[model samples]
Target: MPRNQWKPFQSITVQWISLLLVCLVALPVANASEPKATDIVVRAKSKDAKFIGSSMGGAMVRIRDAESGEILAEGLTEGSTGNTDLIMQQPHRRHQSIAEGAAAFRTSLMLSEPVFVTVEVLAPYIKKQARVAAQTQVWLVPGKHLDGEGLVVEIPGLVVDVLSPQTHRYTQMADAPFPIRANVVMMCGCPISEGGLWDGSQMEVAALVKKDGRDFATIPLALEDVNTFGGELQPDGPGLYQLLVYAYDPRTGNTGVDQVSFIVR
Candidate 1:
């Protein structure tokens, strides 16, 4: 192993190693510039699953750095029509309900590097306190897409259990007792009553029965328990009846409205 003999072999090996290193580093940079985007679809609804839609009609989605809390990308989950930011933009109309607006929110986000981040959903414009803020952690890979779990924000609103009618389309006889079972909660999913965070004195639940596009009768609901409320509806006559149940927490001025269309024999 003479020093002169080693020099020639070492030079060739050094050149081979440098070429290998260059290829490895250049590969990632070339792929990075092409820019792969991740499509994040957000869906919002009430915690009970009885209803699907935000009172605000749409929600805001923000992608933030999980560690630093810095927002990276932002977009909206609006009505069937795109860019429906606020509920007011597309007011409620016949056949077009609030649920139509809060159906799905879609956005594509692109990042230079893959990192751990948080997806934050906010429905602040919801006046009825029908929804709460939602956040979830997800791994954002630069070249792939990620789906999120269903984000539920309970509105301090009313949910009625139609025990008698079985189906929203089913008809109840005028003589049969249409017993109503309902649950009342705060926007944050806290049960409310006379002495809770939302004063029971100001809380009330009522069903507005509409016939022929006019107000027919208003049946008051009695609170059976903290979160349980019920009422019996004896329709004056048999026909097509529209029922609108309203739950209100006067303390915070949060209200929720639920509707049902049923036939009365």
Candidate 2:
């Protein structure tokens, strides 16, 4: 073949190869911008399930089955700030926000069998209500520990109202080894007996008991030794008992007492 005839054919073949190369390289870059449906990350045994962000602004998430696309669970990770960092106790699926309006989905797989959970975080346009802090001032009537099984008191709910502190009172009563009913009392901003020490000249602790809605007896206790606040109930009686505690500190005069009621079996 002549050299001029071969040159023209070679040029045409080279042009065709260059076009094919451009097609292969440009396809991947276009696919990179598309949103992904699945993101799998393997967690260690000790790590907790948490959102990968912090202070997410009203972010919401949902979990779904990968193969079936059935929704399983969901939660909101929006904090006061705009980052979605949260700790989930169980395993599930998660969808996160890529932009303010658009979203990108991600999946989390747990290696630990016990703590398997998936959570989806979403972003809502409107703001949500703020959570209230728990009120420590409202205390159980009888305090924390009890000698018998029936007498126990705890804060009632998850959210304690500050404006209405009285709503948080909760009591637990059950059959006990002994016939005693314990009660709780508190005095704030004033000297109260703690650490087993009380001033002999300062105060007097009093408990007035009533049975069947009738006044029974008033027992006065020396502030120096008034630690236990429970009393033995009559084994034969089936009525309810009421207990009221009053404090008299000479420096602060007489402070009022709180009334608590319990039943006897």
Candidate 3:
């Protein structure tokens, strides 16, 4: 073959080699931008107390993409409520983890770049009336783990359950001054007692009564036993009576309520 002919073929071959090298160099960069799995942890905690755990029915957790409003993960938190002394009594330092082995909802998201997410939690899941919802937003980075006491959503409220003067009860006016009883506890199901932790003596509990849909008496209930508050409700005449029982902690601004109805003959 002629030398000039060989020169042209060599130039064409060099151009193809250059293009191949460019593609090889760009491959890693493209791969780096692809989606990756990111780990996230979320927990629901009672205000001024422990985590919301299995005992009270673990909290429901939902993770959504902030920008798109797409759900990323949905599940319930599982495990214990955590150590009482560590979560409630001890002072916490920066970066201290109180959620070790505590209840949490864990999930992974596929993300290529940093993404903003909204985490919503409904705690004390079994108690519909006492359930509290909380939420928070965070930026998730690919490959980053939002673990170790992860994102804590604090729920503020008490669990109020009316115990006496049962719902839909029928009674005579003579029974008007009947006992009103209720059981109150922290949102985490922590017991409330007169002189113990989560003291009921420090809270205000009462029954707001209504007769035949009209304004009636407001009876203040006194702490009678562990998590129990009692009082008396007296109806003036024969009518439908409704009792709305409530508990409030003035110090923490936490409140909860439950209601019942009865008919007087």
Q: In candidate 1, what residue range of length 10 has the lowest lDDT sum?
A: 80-89
- The 0-to-1 C-alpha lDDT of every candidate, in the order given, reads 0.60, 0.34, 0.91
TM-scores vs. true structure, each candidate: 0.44, 0.26, 0.93
- Collision count for each candidate, in order: 7, 22, 0
TM-score of 1: 0.44
lDDT of 1 by residue, 197-227 (tens): 4444566788888875778889888777777
lDDT of 1 at 204: 77
Tens digit of per-residue lDDT, candidate 3, span 1-265: 9888899889999999999999999998888789999888899989977898898899999998999999989999999988988888889999899887789988888888888989999989999999888889999998888977789999999999999899999999876579999999998888899788788899999999998999899999999999999999877789899999999999899999999999999
Pull out the clashing pairs in model 3. none
Better of 2 and 3 by TM-score: 3
Sort the candidates on TM-score, descending order.
Answer: 3, 1, 2
Which residue pairs in model 1 clash with each other?
77-105, 79-101, 130-155, 156-186, 156-187, 193-200, 194-200
lDDT of 1 at 18: 99
